[model samples]
Target: MAPGYALALAFSVALLVTTDAGNPGLVARITQKGLDYARQQGIIVLKQKLSTLHLPDYSGSYDVGVLGNVDYDINSMVVTDLQLPSSEVTLLPNVGLKLTVSGAYIEIHGKWRVHYLFISSHGDFELKVLGISISVGLSLGSDGSGRPTISTADCSAHISDMQVHFSGGLDWLINLFDDTIASSLRDNLQKQICPLVADAIQNQLEPVLRTLPVTSNIDDVAAIDYSLTGPPIVTAENLDVQLKGEFFERSHRSPPPFSPLPLSIPDDHSLMVYFAVSEYLFNTAGFVYQSAGKLIFNVTDDMIPKDFPVRLNTSSFGKMIPQISKMYPDMLMKLKISSPSAPSLAMKPGNVTISPLLDIQAYAILPNSSLAPLFLLNLSTDAVAKLGVNSSRIVGHLELSSITIALERSDVGPFPVQILSFAVNYYISHILLPEVNDILKNGYPLPLLDHIQLSNLMLKLNEHYLLLGADVQYE
Candidate 1:
């Protein structure tokens, strides 16, 4: 309790503190200030990572191994074989700093240990980086350049389980993966692997993130070559199309009549011609197409030169049928038509055999309804008729093979009157009974319809089309 005794006791304690090697339970306030300086370095690393990398807020736990050393002036001793357990590292609410280190472990030349870390800052990332090896060194000189950079050569680490979770929409996910999803997924995953992400953390980013695949549209859809799979093929709609083939045609005219009682059958005069087109298109009612299938001499607005030749292939029917079925599923119907045999005849007293292909176009109309509109589309072949000149007052023989008609529903709920499709085939022969004395010898006259017949044939006119159908009342 005396002043001299107290002074002596303090000196002894100080000496003991200075000499306390190989001793336990001794705590000393280091005047060296190494821990604070190390914290500043870690903070600097964080700032650089944020500003340059634009990283997302992160929170997780990590186990950091501690490596410490003791250094006084130029003399130094290295520390190793120190280990730490995993601890949580959370993002400081409202801060974006990622703290791999809450605090650091220190070893005085492999002799002593002390651990410490910070809580957090907002809008920053703080995380307990699992299995991260942390090393703290004492600087013996100014500028803190004497400490060693963390090197795998001096330490090691191992991890059992690891995972990462993030939130945001597609673009947010993009930035997380650094603007490229594939690259991001790869880099994020690689971040889990120890050395690459860890090693690159100081130099460059190598985070491998997992990515998902995408198909933007049908074009992106690729067909698998299963034996059953193929490029899409055409089917339906064009199943049954008649009236696009070779056809023999005949026309007849009647002579004048003067009898008052007016009950007389006129004589016959007819011409025979064959018609064909280069190509065909199954289209809207009477979408007449000619010119080798390319130039559409559409009957609606397209007028053909009187001599324009075109081929009408049955193939066009296949294309048209599918489209038509899609439009008129319920009301349209088709039935096949065929004749037993074609009739044979001569037009100009010469030997000629004409087998004409029959084609018909007709329409059906509902009598009374909102939809009671006219749908005049059909194809049919009439029975062969024969009349010739040698019977000379007679005409020709006519036969037909098949006919088809595709009718559309107008305002009518269903087609009201059906127009039977018909094809007419005919030829001229020498009339033996008439004695051949007339001015137009063996020469058959064109089936020129008289004014009465032409006037009697009723046809409705529209801005774009003219329709003729089944029960057309000649008005």
Candidate 2:
């Protein structure tokens, strides 16, 4: 298959197996934060109008005549003191959201122009609106770029009490017709202002969502791609978002055979992420190791005392010597190590295992003559690991619990030396494990989308995948 095609196929397979379902509480928290942020910005403008107004003769205003063909223009409307109570969100079947905004108060300032008797009278008006409520029904879907978007289906707004204050030449006229003016304003606002608010929300929110960094690159070596599969689900308690994607290294190699299948979502979590381990991700590590060739560790004579004594006690080697001293006390030992093959990953309940084959060789000069082989060993170790996530990044640690040494003839000895097993195991446990941990310590940085972070992260491992879940909090 073509490289791009292969990559796409792999991603599809990964998604089929990996299901990253969201938590309702986390969704609600994120939505609330987003709303709070919008309120803080405080610059939404709503322009509405009533084309014409008809009135009978005014009773009090300077012997006014019948008012007909009165046009009204609300030049600008700003919302303040807007509050969203602890309202519930309901997901319309296969659509978007049934949102409720209750106990909201807004202070609006606008200019109203009225045309009456071939004369236009303009006035600056201030309205203190109380007992405001809004209900919106919309569908959440993705745009061309895979960002979440909203399509309004229905919207309605209600205002129980509105105190209107007016200025300019028409001020006294409006005061005289306060009740009529209020009723007209309410009718116009319900028809025009409500829909405008809904549209304004969509316009403000969609762009912000699109700009979020859902996909992230890690140190130019690997990348985590987050692509949405469908629109978010809104429920009475919270919102649920589903994400599917894959992680791949720069090498484009596939993961080893043991890569796990995706796991299921955990129960009652504020936020949950279910991820499948891909062959590409595991093989990438091997490719990087192979490209670096061999790693050499030099032990100088100064590091080891001249009278250093080593003991060998194993079933294979028995007790050969009580203590063996180095013949060439001043010489240095060079240990060369390399991974002969790629590493494989397997997921177990609450842990993951990584197995890699290693080839190790050590050489040192003897007092009598030339350099000699101290030992040569081939082995595979299973490093079981666990991951922890913080606000900034994920951290991992590994423990080598199983080791299998492949016996082979070497110049150093006629039989397999027990000391070689101990040496290789020590190198893997003490040296290799820490190096892997360090790499994991600098793991993928969590993207802060719109100043929101995943907090209190927890992990669970299953037969085929790892599940990461967390609560949502503002940074």
Candidate 3:
């Protein structure tokens, strides 16, 4: 049950939480349907553990009416077959989880030796245990490092019936007292079951929980933080976990400028898990790249297709402002386009938009290989992004909704701002956006637990956040 226990502790550490905007940026919910799957896996693991059980030798002396004093020892008991036909997992609301197993049956083979004063009889025996039942309650919490911790709150095991059959000379005499021997065996078996369960949780499951990566590198430039913001929230139908799903620059771990907005995920049992990501996650990415100075790009004439009507040179600008044709004719030009600040994202019920402030500096090449400053334009735009999940990452493309252009400074003298606006908008729509889209097509990685895969996913845009509902497959 290590895997099942790991899954439970990993996702099951909460109660009703406050709706503070500073609440966890990431929230995941595990429904009853998910618990059912976990229960199935748990039973398989339990059976394997029980099959290797080591029961201590049982030896005792008892007096039988006509047989006088009889002494018997049952040793080297080995489990031959075990069956767990019924089990269930139930959420205990504020208490955590309770697992109950009933109707379990087990068969054991062992050696028995009995002494009756003058003679001793030795042979093999069969022990059948029936109506076995076990119940365990688990309490989940987190350690200082944000890793989940699991401890057994309460546990119990019961054996309703045990029958022993002996085969050997004078075995008939021992059979008459087998009921008394079986009772002692039943008591010993019941005492071992719960302690083994507790040890498995402490020794096997707790270590796996520590292996969860709270922070993982997404790429060379950035890494994501998936640490729990606080303890989990528990409801009758769900176990909710909250995480600080923010990305930071690899070299610098500065916090993002904005805080996560209040996010919520409805109970959807059909899916194994539900992940709700806030706008803060995307904005932190913008901040990381902006702070890293990786958001800037230099566009040259060589990058433009030769067949384009307008070239990136003084000659092309001269068509609009004739003064440029007399000064630097046939000279090439360069545009250094970069964001002055981190772009901000705005999400609403059916739309997700972004506003980025950019500074585009145009320069003309001089005969001496020096750059002659032409003009500078401050650009801002309203763009909407179409998002999709690819593999474990989120991939998206931006669509320009509106553009704003302003002349900040110029060395070639003043020209009508309206004149360059058309060309600027056209350049952005046809050239710059395509390049941005190409990079966005690669997408950013999403934080996920080990060996967990998302399938049958659905993404929904809500006010201030994005909800991703998916069925999870544990490898």
Candidate 4:
């Protein structure tokens, strides 16, 4: 592998490059291209190496440390008198040549630090980001092996710092919450890094003073360093705006224990159907929720009249008995409705947080949409018998292993919906407080991976998205 060989290719990133890609502008072109390349590579490396790179939580105050290694390729080069402090950072120690067609290899070699190249490490904060930060610096200079000779005054695109912040969604934030927002925030964060990267490149290459080809397309053929000025979009226009906030039990520790429910019910069961169903969803169904609370919901007045009577099912109640001895696993939650009067259902174990099994799916809608739920509900607890309005109540029981649903109508948009959510079923274990205690106590799905691989890590933008709508302000 060469020591380091980096070049810049500038497409119209919502700016105007009214100059040529000649020696005068080469510095800026190279610096910008170098920074661009470095950042892109950094993203891929970060994702591929996420398993190996561990980090500390930042929900509160905690110290973080940088512990990992990354590799890159460049021509063999060495630099002396480099001012950078970190020895790990590699930069231009050997100059590259771009020969002309006349001299076989029209190699164009110059003496200048157009873009400062060097690697340096810096401390980072979680910043309520609940993620980790990586900071690096780069510089450009001549290899120390050669004698001082008059060349171009090597300019430098000193990336004082380049960082990639990382984090897991809400589930990982706490054992109880199955926060779906975590994954959304992760994607938004990647977008936030784009502008910072663009600035880094601009700083490094603005002075290279190189000329560009005369083609109408600012996004030109592959070359080491390049520059163009036009209205077309580039990688720089992918913008994202995010507002991150979270609600968690700042106090960590198990909750006080509650006595088990009696396995009996009254003879009359009516108004208690709603609470019975709710409790069934939480305690029996092992649903994910923000906190442990009594089951609650409303039932159709006709479904159970004031004097309606029902009987409890004991024989069929033995099935679907989940181990209720674990704490609520870290998971994401969501409430979806499709109509105004339709009963709204809450789902647990977000797609991003839950285990690969225990199927749980969730989707979001706008303010006016209603909810349509499909679940084979089974409620057999003796608590349902006691939740009666008074006069009389029976332990109305329901048991179903699975419930499939079909949507009547929906107004949701093009945003992607993730249904492959599975959270560690902590509700059952949490309430039972004995069965799955071992599983929760240990914090499962332990790091079973040692290494990671990336076969086709790629980025391909469609023609429509490439048309940038912003300005480069390339001063």
Compare the candidates by lDDT and give the number of the best one: 3
Clashing pairs for predicted structure model 3, backbone only: 14-232, 14-233, 14-234, 15-233, 15-234
By lDDT rank, best first, the candidates go: 3, 2, 1, 4
- lDDT score at residue 272, model 2, on the 0-100 scale: 29
State the lDDT of candidate 4 residue by residue for 166-268, as single tens digits: 2332212221121222343344333433334334334333222111122222112211111222211112312111000011122322321221121111222
- Model 1 lDDT-worst window of ten: 209-218
Alpha-carbon local distance difference test for all models: 0.21, 0.50, 0.75, 0.20
- The best-first sequence of candidates by TM-score reads 3, 2, 1, 4
TM-score of every candidate: 0.15, 0.63, 0.87, 0.14
lDDT of 1 by residue, 114-200 (tens): 122422211211111233343222111111211112212221223322222222222222123221222332344234333432444
Model 2 residue 231 lDDT?
A: 68
Kindly report which residue stretches of model 4 are placed more than 4 angstroms away from their true locations once superposed: 1-291, 302-401, 404-475
Candidate 4: give its CA RMSD in angstroms: 32.6
Estimate candidate 1's RMSD in Å. Answer: 42.0
Best by TM-score: 3
Error of 2 at 462 (Å): 3.9
Off by over 4 Å in 3: 1-21, 117-120, 367-370, 417-427
Candidate 2 residue-wise lDDT at 373:
66
Error of 4 at 31 (Å): 19
lDDT by residue (tens digit), candidate 3, 1-475 = 1111211111111000022247677777778887787677667777877777787887888888876889988898899999999999888887788999999999999988889898999888899999999999988777677766778999999998887889987788788789988888888789888887888778766676676567777556677677776666666889887877776778877777778778767656787777788777767777777787766777788777778767789999899877777788999988887788877777788878777787889999888989988889999888777877754666677788998889999888888877888778877777777766665666655556566677887888878788877776767
Q: What lDDT is obtained when candidate 2 is compared to the true structure?
A: 0.50
Give the range of the ten consecutive residues with the poorest summed lDDT in model 3: 8-17
